[model samples]
Target: MKPVLIRLLLLLAWAPFYTQAQQRFSFEIEGGHFLKDGKAVPIISGEMHYPRIPHQYWRHRLEMLKAMGLNTVATYVFWNLHETEPGKWDFEGDKDLRRYIETAGELGLMVILRPGPYVCAEWEFGGYPWWLQNIPGMEIRRDNPEFLKCTKRYLDRLYEEVGDLLVTRGGPIIMVQAENEFGSYVAQRNDIPLEEHKRYNAAIRRQLADAGFDAPLFTSDGSWLFEGGTTPGALPTANGESNIENLKRVVDQYHGGKGPYMVAEFYPGWLSHWAEPFPNVSASWVARQTEKYLQNDVSFNFYMVHGGTNFGFTSGANYDKDHGIQPDMTSYDYDAPISEAGWVTPKYDSIRNVIGKYVDYVIPEVPAPNPVIEIPSIRLTGIADVLAFAKRQEPVESPVPLTFEQLRQGYGYVLYTRHFNQPLAGMLEIPGLRDYATVYVNGERVGELNRYYNRYSVFVEIPFDATLDILVENWGRINFGEEIVNNRKGIVGPVTVNGMELSDWFMYRLPMDGAPGPDKTAEVRAGTPEASFLHRKPVLYTGSFNLSETGDTFIDMSAWGKGIVFINGKNIGRYWQAGPQQTLYVPGVWLKKGENRIVIFEQLNDGPKNEISAVKVPILKELKS
Candidate 1:
């Protein structure tokens, strides 16, 4: 064995008592309780993802969590955010995992790190790196050789950064989850065999141990997942907002009638998707549910004390067996105690009061809310032709339509264009359109296709022989269940016209990371979209707004169709006129005192006014689903 490998193994062997002589901060599981340094300490944690929030505001949000009477903060380390591409890893800036954890520790807050190779946090590809899909026959979240090899490397890198930071090594991290909600998915989806599911869970626990994580590793799942998700050594924990009786019963039964009762994910409010209203679990409901758990002396963590934003193209979707694909909204304001803009809601006050009644220590005062500003309508100038941008792209010729992964593309839309020899008019079938697409023939918009409702094929009529362009947008990947195993975006099958499949296509990778500089943008007054540009062709609308003072505000994007927004140079997130989310939250930290640039990549715009404004408050809850 290599010297470094031997040294790491030795360190793993001494993990239990690595820092015992210096600090008495051990967190171990005993009979129905978590013994912190041999004293029973109730863990009241709240889930807050760091990548979703700005790195500058992590401390501010942590303070709010502390004031809410939460002793611990739980967060999932999204693997894809760090390893955007295979063999290359990033742990700096917003992707810095150690800094977030260390900051929580500085504030005297314990940590529960859920570093799942597959987190399923409504994040893109369930936190799996997109490059994983490019690997031949790569079966993820399974006991596959290639997948495990990659997973081991990732965990090893994670341990190198935060291993010594574990509670066993005098750090604030009390516990770490083996994998997130795998049991719930196995039972519900059953994509893999039962024995393989069991073996996969055991293998993951082993890999976590080999990676030098000597702290108590546990499995988190819903009440029904114990049978499939729990292993022999790892403690079993349930997740839910209410049903305290059932939660305790299942967990107790799983551990052979005696074990620590931990609700790893107690949902105060649920996740929202595009076109659906934001989830609205009442503050009273959360207070009552928490009181029940506290009354029973059961420990729990609020799923989202503050859900920031999905930001960029990291949001994931859900593929239901009946309802087809449901793409998640960009704003991850999980309607929790703390709002996305870091404001304390009524739910925060209610949770604090209820938690205070149970804990002996005094709850600190809630942190003051952040300031917000409303700006007048900002007129959009400079219309940059998107087709011109496409002309500069290097096109790949393929026999049939190729998936985004097949072409080595990560996120954003892909343009698939082909010229037909003869005039054609019939039903165009894209059997495997992953998400949404816009069909155009001879530079004219034909129809729209959506994956959410399973609109796979669209009828079209063409006058004569002309070029056909099918621009497909990758909204997001499925984050959960069996479908996620192969959630590759773009068209995976041939484009059939009148039952005849077409061949020889030009594929363009539009990751939309950014665009050409000022030379590409045309300086013009804001009005209806220029008729010269095709309606289906993507347009880059650029504008600037001057601000004397800056604070957190929401940009009203209701006027725009489905597309992405960029403030200055930073990519904010996607915006859809779909009912639920109509605005994008803009943190003041991203803004400056002088002129701030704004760019919108609109896919379709049928609205009258072409203006963007700032609102003081975020439009969180809209019409219900």
Candidate 2:
């Protein structure tokens, strides 16, 4: 043992193959034409943001990536994630990006780092700190001096953290993408010419150079990703282009010849929203693309090998106004080969089968799939009454208006309280009510807004000396697109009543935590989502099952409204009544026999009571099956 240890210590090359492997890398397109070492390496990679998976599961997730026949793991360097606050940084917790890099190396995988100070990955503020938005005349992504200053700061910090992880430094990072799909949104910018693109890349280039990091820099964009994206230096990048000729355009247009070609984001399955059905593309179609890429030696990266959660308010939405997609569910389940929980799907197996039959490498057996058991449905009734506890003791003043930011609360509800001038009631218009709102006159519920539709309405009646109160909840910010850049919570703008804009609002905050606060349970009074079922402001219910032994189970979500679920004490994820997500995956780790507590906090009411149980099968479509 001593001799072996000495020999191993003496041979420093004992590091993993990825850590010791060296390759000159470049991007080519279509037909597996990307060349490395003067030959096509025909890379197969998967995108899994480091912050998405829990650190404990990093290696597990990487192993899963490798098992999927992926030779590379791409991750985004979420600036906001690293630097939670400006000038301050945290590389631990979910921010341990350095570990993410080293782990990839250890797993014999390559790395593609996307360190966008403006990484628009459906993150809050597109990865910008909220304080940046408060800056005067501040602009993000493009060339705003404030934005540039901040970007540089983040770059400096990043270099200090993991610059050595580059392949040039004998690490797994073979390539780095400048920004994702920048050309897709160039028109919204200041309409600057290509020179603007040059300036951005130039600054990045300068930073990398100054850091003594010479791992080969490249910018990636579509054949036209260059239009809005930083061009010249950025490697030409594309996604989901199955045709060899189409990829040729990107490489030919940029490299003028051929080198390393890659699909930075190859979409296999699509993402689904609250109301929409699953956005599933055929697994066979995706398998064919993978087969072609490898057969032709084209290197590619799956857009999301694992799409993690948009926890809190960071979920970005499509079109700027909708915060649905970006904030993705609490589940980072991208419907990729790998689910958010690091479980490999059938897509993974299909992709792996072809790679095994066709490629030179052999991947190990995957960790056993999570336990899935069906819990016999339980009828849940009025365990106890739930209702609101009044906090304001004084005579409530005129209608008070409060903005989302002023509330000092990130997500959830905000209360605006003010006294009316005289006996009055008319069509109430909350023009500045940003996302979602629930109108209550004198502590009685009157109306609500879906926000996704931009409107939810009802009539209002007031008595003499009436107190005006409108509670607007920051349901969620739009999780994708340009709108995500400015996603603020609560009543973003203002609250209006009739023709007058309410002012001097007294405020109340309702984050509601997860599920419902049990102590605030209301008497089971009503039975519809539109009515107040809980007489209490918050509600809580508890149930226990003696397992004697714990087993994996699928908590059927068909019976519950929108709320969160907990086992023992871990948050599984948010649950919505909306289908096709009728089940929540619950690992047995959080459960215990002899009496594990299950608590539920449902905000809206659709029925008098509900039921929950476990399932032996995955309730989701295609991917799980």
Candidate 3:
């Protein structure tokens, strides 16, 4: 036979095998059980946000979940991380949802996509783009026409990236969540009519369907909140729920008493705020819960088998009648089965043992631990004052203080300057201070106001014709509860002196989107004296450390007060002396073999020593009295 004819015959013989391997399958919730290809399958899943974990570590984290006997990997697609600005969409690099989903499928694991227009995953603004607040007549997560229109556009754009990866399209994505925890929001919001909430949720569901997300849809909320959160025709799932009886009852009540029940967000550990003690769930208790879930045939997903770093300005705030504005700590660790740096904990082993007993197939061995390294302390010299950099930019003039949203600024600090015509001394009150503010009178730091404690007023003594600069840092937008709608960073309303309102402001946009480089530092250092640079204020410090080899390391900012750290131009995360999180996780993949740059935008480094050490472990809790 001729070589060409033989090759053609071989290709024809293999065609069917290849086609079958890539064939799509039906995934349905029927007879109270999850049916994949007409066979009942128990979904043991774990939640891990793609944006939270570095793109390079996605496979390792997913593998960890599979080894723990989780057949599925669930993730929340952060919209803010994608469309950072209005009309500017990004689905590349770390923000690539398609690649992440495809990677999971390649590893023989299914995906549960929770692409929320409002995820409320301790993410800034519940994953809503900052520009959404700037739109006229915009009301988020509600029946507002502008919000609905924007949501449709966002979902349409998202589907363009991952629509082909749906289970119906030969992809691993079996189910998708429609609007996260809407029932909680509806319950908290009393002013908005219940009918309006229903309309908004229905609109989100329609939008998801219209965007070609043909996978089975589910709505996750607390068991009691199914009434407000569940959309018509979508399966209702519970969060933070374990009782099989209650879970079945809620799902049956909202979803026609069907059998396939799922606890969409089973909380193994709780989220931590800056000042509060780091929350830790007992490993044995979690194991017990897992056994209960499996024994009762109730499918469950660990809210975060591995809660990666929040990185950049992504960590969000939580506000309620009891807690007020509690901004989430940068380290999203969640104290899950898998640590923030991808290290398996006792919880991981506990959960694995529980799952191994129930699964029919052999669980894969846990992958080897990632390498971790420690570097000696590197001295970071004060190179620039944040306000000094702000002075270089032309200020936006307004009669009253404007918000970070009003100025079209998303994250970081915004310097609001007001020139006092005469010497004014009184209780200066900023009624609309969103989060944290540092008051300065003519380059002299006076006092500070923290929104976390609801302290928006401070005593200020202004010099004649002095410039009153209120440099406000946007800790993060409220990600949970009803306060999310009221989330406008920086100065939102009027700044009053005693009982009178102050006016004539010069707002400098210090969004601090990127770390200041040597060129910027040189300019500030050369222009200012060393004596003036050591003041207790927000200062930019720069330094470099040599590394022979790279591995995962934590940048210990225990010496520093509060600030954001950037390594090799990458925004690692924020650090504060407020306790609970003292070190920022720096993935070794981001480092080079030789010299690596580190920049600290220190908000309050009062001590003489200006240094940070690359430690081996994380310091999650250090509660100050």
Global lDDT of each model? Answer: 0.83, 0.62, 0.86
Estimate the TM-score of every prediction.
Answer: 0.94, 0.82, 0.94
Off by over 4 Å in 3: 1-24, 522-533
TM-score-better candidate, 2 vs 3:
3
Cα distance off (Å), candidate 3, residue 336: 0.3
Residue 318's C-alpha lDDT in candidate 3?
Answer: 84
Model 2 over residues 1-625: C-alpha lDDT tens digits? 6543453354344444544454434333333354444555666888888766657667877888887777888887877666665687778866788778888877778788877655666555566665565567876665567778887788877876777667666667777666556666564544656667557656656665665556555555555565556455545766666777778666666765665666777887666555555666677878888888877657788878777554444454455333333224455566788875567778888888888877677887887655544568644443433224223323233344545555445555555666676777776776556565556666655676656655745567877787766656554555445555565665555455576565766666655445443455443423345334343233445555667666556777776666556666555655666555666666555566677667665544445555568776545542220
The CA-based lDDT of model 2 is what? 0.62
Q: Runs in model 2 with CA error above 4 Å?
A: 1-40, 190-194, 208-213, 308-314, 320-327, 373-400, 419-421, 465-469, 511-553, 565-572, 587-599, 606-611, 614-625
lDDT of 1 at 613: 92
lDDT of 3 by residue, 1-625 (tens): 9543464466456544533555467788788889999999989999998888889999999999899999899999888888877767777788978779878887888999998988888999889998888889898888889988888888988876677678886778999999999999889997989998898899999999998898899999999998899999788989988788999888888877676888999999999998899998999999999999998888889998889999999999888687578889999999899999999899999899989998998899999978999998786654676777888889999997888888988999899988777998999998789888888888878888998877889998887988888889999998888778888888888889887899889999977678888777543442246735557767788878899999999988877788898999999988878877988999989998999998888777475445669899899987762
Tens digits of lDDT, candidate 1, 1-625: 9644575577667655634433437788877679987889888999999999999999999999999999999999888888777867788898888789878887888899999988999999899988898788788888898998899888887887689888877888888899888887787657578998888888888889999998888889877878988888788988873676787688889887875787888888899988776778899989998998888878899998999998889899988889888888888888888988998889989999999888877778888877789987887766665555665678999898899999888898888988877777889999789789888777677788888767888887766677888888888889998888768889987789889999999988888877435665553444645634534556777788999998888888766777888987888898877758888989889898999998888877554335679898777556333
lDDT of 2 at 322: 39
Q: Which candidate is the best by TM-score?
A: 3
Selected candidate, larger TM-score, 1 vs 2: 1
